[model samples]
Target chain A: MTDENIANHLKSLKKYTPARIGVGRTGTRPLTKDFLSFRTDHAAAVDAVYGEVSSKLIEELDLFSVETCYETKDHYLKRPDKGRILSEEAKTIIKEKCTPNPQVQIVVSDGLSASAIDENILDVYPALLDSLSMYGLNIGTPFFVKGGRVACMDDIGEILAPEAFILLIGERPGLVCAHSLSAYMCYQPKKGMKESDRMVISNIHRSGTPAIEAAAHMGTLISKMLDQKKSGVGLVI
Target chain B: MYKKTTLLGITYEFHSLKEIMAKANEEKSGDELAGISAENMKERMAARAVLAETTLSDIRSYPVVAPEKDDVSKLIEENVNEEIYGVIKNWTVADLREYILNDEHLSKELLQIGTGLTSEMIAAVTKIMSNLDLIQAASKITVITHCQTKIGQKGVLASRAQPNHPSDHLAGIRASLFEALSYGIGDAVIGINPVIDTTDNIYALLNETKEVIDRFDIPTQNCVLSHISSQMRAIEKGAPADMIFQSLAGTQTGNESFGISISMLEEATSLIFEKGTAEGQNRWYFETGQGSELSADAHFDVDQLTLESRCYGLAKHFNPFIVNTVVGFIGPEYLYDSKQVIRAGLEDHFMGKIHGLPMGVDVCYTNHMSADQNDMDNLSTLLSTAGVNFVIGVPMADDCMLNYQSLSFHDIATLRNVLGVSAAPEFADWLKKQGLTISSGQLTKQAGDPSFFL
Candidate 1:
């Protein structure tokens, strides 16, 4: 291809708008200060609500194995390669905190948006596990990833060899909501497995989707993946 | 209402609390007990008023500086002035917003700070109003970059001699991969050059990639390949390999280039599958075959491939194949109008059908507008509306360093909230729940936590 040819070829593709622009300025108003103050107050209120919910869930579910994992956003954002590898301490905790071997391994991560996990996991996780139990599958030791990515599944799969691996992680940060989460599942997940090798259940949140329904659906899909031995486009379901 | 009085107190020397209290008692206008309480309250109010006055004075000392576009040295100089005062009195917090909006130069400077107070507020507010849970769920998505090589027979050397270089094909691939990966999509299937030539060196390049495959342990079985020769050879054989492989390859590339022949690629895959079946081994198989040259009358017709055929062909080869196209650097003007190219390619190749694969647009970062939120949102929304899945480019240096290569969880949430779309939220939330974090300067873990989700 000539310079002209290459130039012409490039001339034909669509353009990309920055992700932030999709979220326009909130707007200017005489009550803008009041609105901002109110928002901050609401944030505090929500935090309190979620905190109470979390404690209740822990109590109601009889989950004595829960541990609080904390990390700074700065550390999580700078080291993606590090994100792919689990910390020794985390591994130790995982080994000690829950069952060792089971039919499947389920993990929850805060990913880039910790609020996502803090907000939705309490409801979604239990629903999913219940579905799994109904399918006669035993869940392995469940752990939390502080700053996770999709590739982290490979590391988790390598560390804990389960028949199926289900990872509920946060999505990339956007302008609108920071609490969304997705469940990615694969059979015998290993390093360098293309995304097509996995099945995803996405849009599981309160506003756009029902977390409970998504969990139940994810449960059904995982069972199907185990039975079919395929995912993505290959899985019949 | 009680009488109002203003008192100013300045001490030339420090006095003990007892002495101050005695003086306050001496000036009381009531009985001893009430006088003491009133004196204490007066002192307390006086202290608070003094502190507030000082703070206001300090803020007034420093002039508010506007943001710069290229050079931030001036803003820094002004910020230093503000710091010396221990408080910013003249500039209200609202002034910060004005500075960002009115002065592009200052905003660029602030971006250098990585995580400034303003950005943090923006990120936090954005996260709250947006439905982050949904963004995370849809995080794993596909981004396809569509392109078609200009019609002509040009050797690899000749193509390399041009400005884009090996970058032409690489650009398309990079854009598609970038878009897919940015959105947390793990796999990306790219379209091979439609006008395959005997002299092309891609085969050699693939051989080199073998090391990458082995080192990464990437499953090579899923990475399929198809060429004209492979298709033709499959057709000549009576085996069903020709139909399977030809159809698959055609479907994969049909969304990419109209010139791709799905039947040819499918035919080859079928032959290979049959060969594997005959051998009685469940081995990984990728079809290799050849295609008959088109007659003069049939040449144009042969070049046109349908979207359905392309999708089917790719589905046959790799179940969830990602179809991408190329958009070469035509010129600066083309930078602003890239959608025209994608529209034309879609019209020409798929006949305006939307494929399941993620579609994307790739361009040079040089042409990309710097630190323009409006531009970014416009571009993202346009692609999303057009059914484009992702965008690939050299994220702005500041953005990349800030680790904002793709949409941030906060940004994605904002998009969903504004557009009332669930996909963005689902995708973002899914990424976050996976514990995948994007920092400003690098892709790193958060503190002492493990990177993996186990």
Candidate 2:
């Protein structure tokens, strides 16, 4: 290619997405730095998937803790079904300790990457609580679900009987970005609701959409979802 | 083409550019760029840029041909005739058929063009196309495998020393090639992975490689992989593109990440078919691996390993001369340790072989991977046991530019020693004649052997 052509290729504007392109290649392979960076990113991703959320974060949030059906980390990684429901003892604990029929139910889980919450929750959780309180939405007893998936919010909602449910969970980590989180919200969340029936504000982290900003947006979105009695694709932003 | 399908009760419609695209994501060959297909996209982009630049000035200057004025069949015939390559001059459809039927050593390129023949015309054709014929036509394409010295049979597992440099400087490339050649490796293609992937740089690199091969009289073809479009552009600018090289993904979405689509891939395939003449064989060289889907986020809930297997369908569709799987180059998120990396190599090879691909395992890992040379040794030995087509032969199998560790010339020698397989006959003979090999036809000297005594 000519120098002019090289300049043109370099000048092509890259999209502001966490996609691995525009990073030049050395011949057919990725450049050394790029390859090493990819490795670093990948190592973090694997660690995120396998790592655990800290109990200190849960205690700091002043939330009750419960367990999902998953018996272990390997079980959680391999089985999606187990991560979607409350354990027998955990269901009993939730029924006893948590209030029912609240306006909004806030739940947490290490869905795929614990570091997502371990790192970003301090910024997002308080901001979300402040926003919800400012909106005059009555909040239920907040709690954490260990070894949980996004669908666990439905089970929580069924038990707590909330008007709206917001599950702050870890998004599946990719090599591009690992410390990303999501808030999957649903109006009257219950068992058997399809994935599309839920709405999510994803890519919540410092580098992506700021956790505080996402939490503030989630408050408005949840309020709107409760008013419309819907919270998915049908809800217009 | 449009495909209407339901995945997980969600109905979706996608614009399918190839029949393969309609079937893609359903079973196999899903990703778009599985080879020089990336180049096809780049060329299309380049062409689009030119078209956009001239639109205001040239749009009204050109006369629009009336669709009704052209005969549909005649247009189809003309287009197909123009694309068909490797046939003798002035040969009619019948004449071409006769020529192909009469020649026992017809190039795979010529035979592939036979697929476009009309039904009535095909009926007149006597030679039936088969996979066995494709295997036999291996030496017809301009690939390294098609080098005068045949890809040695009897489970020899043709080898190539792929010395990837930080910069594809001619000297670094030559140093790697010569050192490997000194060890009797790289009877296959002397392919280089350049740091700069552009038409001019790659062309210069390829020309330098050609000079080395010509000067040393090496019995191998030179492959400079600069994406397919740039390679085609370089070739047009007088670059030696002995074999077309491209990286491919398993899913169309993954291929698109590399800036390629099925139609674009087909376009590049046809361009290579038309622009270059092979020594009678398959000319395309493909590189694929696991984790592309995961990296590109196109795995569609499938595991990276399974998705990698599906990618072979893309290589098989094109009839590639060499399909090298860079086993652990993507790093730990996909394949964490040496065990995982080794298993991935074995799985990719088996999957490629099942799809009738000429599989070559680049038993390699990235620097961040918790893998070592011993892991490559184990995996490549296992691959050799399964009769893989080839293994990469770099100086030490550690690519300076790419920052990945792979099998070295010494590793290839080890495989030969342990597995009892030899290099291509011509390369092995050359090694023996040059006193690099002992009488046992291996690189290593026996304990009591005095073939290299002072």
Which candidate tops TM-score?
Answer: 2
DockQ score, prediction 1? 0.01
RMSD of 2: 16.8
Instruction: Give each prediction's DockQ, rounded to 2 decimals.
Output: 0.01, 0.03
Q: Give the per-residue lDDT of model 2 (tens digit) for A2-118.
A: 556544533332211122333433322335775567557657866887788899889999988899999987556535567888999999999998889999999888888888989
Question: For all candidates, what are the clash counts?
Answer: 159, 26
Model 2 TM-score, 2 decimals: 0.47
Tens-digit lDDT track of model 1 for B98-205? 332343433134333212222112211111111222122112222222111110011000000000112224333333323322333321212222223332333422
Off by over 4 Å in 2: A1-237, B1-149, B274-277, B444-454
Question: Which CAPRI quality tier does the interface of model 1 achieve?
Answer: incorrect
Model 1 C-alpha lDDT per residue in residues A107-199, reported as the tens digit of each score:
776554456666788789888888898899988877666556677778667667677889887654332344667888888877888778888
- Judged by DockQ cut-offs, the docking class of candidate 2 is incorrect
Reference-based lDDT, residue B281, model 1: 19
Backbone clashes counted, model 1: 159
Task: Evaluate fnat for each of the predicted models and list the values in order.
Answer: 0.00, 0.00
Q: In model 2 chain A, where is the ten-residue run with the lowest total lDDT? A: A13-22
